[model samples]
Target: MNRLPRLRGQLFERHEITVEKDIVRARQAVGRAMDGLGAKAIRKTRLVTAASEIFRNGLNYGGGAVALIHCDAGNRMVWVDCIDDGPGIEDMALALRDGYTSGTGLGRGLGGAKRLVDEFDIVSEPGVGTHVRLAGRA
Candidate 1:
């Protein structure tokens, strides 16, 4: 497997969330990494959904590529950043609206994802692509 290096802290390992079977792989990796790291069922589920949302959005809206970098933030918190280099969002506010969709999706992805995480940051430019970082206590 032509894979990226896995980063680990204690029993936790970080991974890149991409397409194919890697999304499932990444979810399992996260579950293993957060087990007993104070990751509650609700928070873990939320983070997983948030992770899935960003990856799908990156493939659909971005340039068919996305990078999800996960790491331990010490103190039982895990941080993940979903980065992409594609034509960026045209309007941030509009894009974040509950029922906004640039494609055929239901349009609730970004907004719903925001509700699932403790911290959410999205940055993009017309030609610069998009980067979304999500952090939460697991």
Candidate 2:
């Protein structure tokens, strides 16, 4: 017989990223979640930074977005999903590259966020929208 992992505690939080202030809220929410999971200071900071970058990208490039935060206590892991309904990236490769920005910023958002998390996934459709998933382990 195969054994599956036992389930423990789980957390779910959602935030709408429609404005500049929402990004700050999302970062705070992420920090709180990480702290609850007993994540170290550096881990919490990295996750919060990654969340902020993703939120900004979704708001600036995707026109707006929603963020869903999840925590699995048994696994000591947390992840966030940012979904946006706007003009999506035409070239994911170019978009993920460092210093590649369609806007005025330095263009380090996507790549930098990826480096901060343990897991990262991004999907986009040119005429549809984009979804970014970032995860970290405590």
Candidate 3:
């Protein structure tokens, strides 16, 4: 399921920051997004690092997208989901490689994203979009 809980003090935040070459804004947006979802120092750092990459991908490559930050009460988890309706990845496997890029990309992409989180889920289609959901516990 792509749904997260709406618990109190949850502080879920959604944003559609512009992807106009301002990666700093993207990073801050992510940090602010996870301010109080029961995140600790290490976990929040990991999540923000992953989020910065995804946010940049959305802004730089995709035609921009939305970021979803929410709490998973059932699992005591904090999740971040970024969705973009940009030109879908042509080769999912290749794009996931540690150093794969089609220009305007840093090549870290999915590999780095996966390493930063406890759980990662990704789905993409050529003409559709990309949906990435990452989870980390408090």
Q: Which candidate is the best by TM-score?
A: 2
Report the number of clashing residue pairs per model: 1, 0, 0
In order, candidate lDDTs are 0.69, 0.86, 0.72
Ranking of predictions according to TM-score = 2, 1, 3
Per-candidate TM-score against the hidden true structure: 0.80, 0.91, 0.80
**After best superposition, candidate 3 residue 55: deviation in angstroms?**
1.0
User: In model 1, where is the ten-residue run with the lowest total lDDT?
Assistant: 1-10
What is the per-residue lDDT of model 3 for residues 17-125, given as tens digits with 9 covering 90 to 100? Answer: 4755445655565565455555677888897888877777777777787777776565767777778887778888898897889885678878898899897877777
What is the C-alpha lDDT profile of model 2 across 1-138, one tens digit per residue? 111222234646889999999999998988888988899999998988998999999999889999988888888888888889889889989998999999999989999999999988888888788888888887
Clashing pairs in 2: none
RMSD of 2: 5.6
lDDT of 1 by residue, 13-123 (tens): 444544656666665665555565668888888887887787778767775554454556465666565666778888999999998999998899899989998878878
The local distance difference test score of model 3 is 0.72
Candidate 1 — which residues are off by over 4 angstroms?
A: 1-18
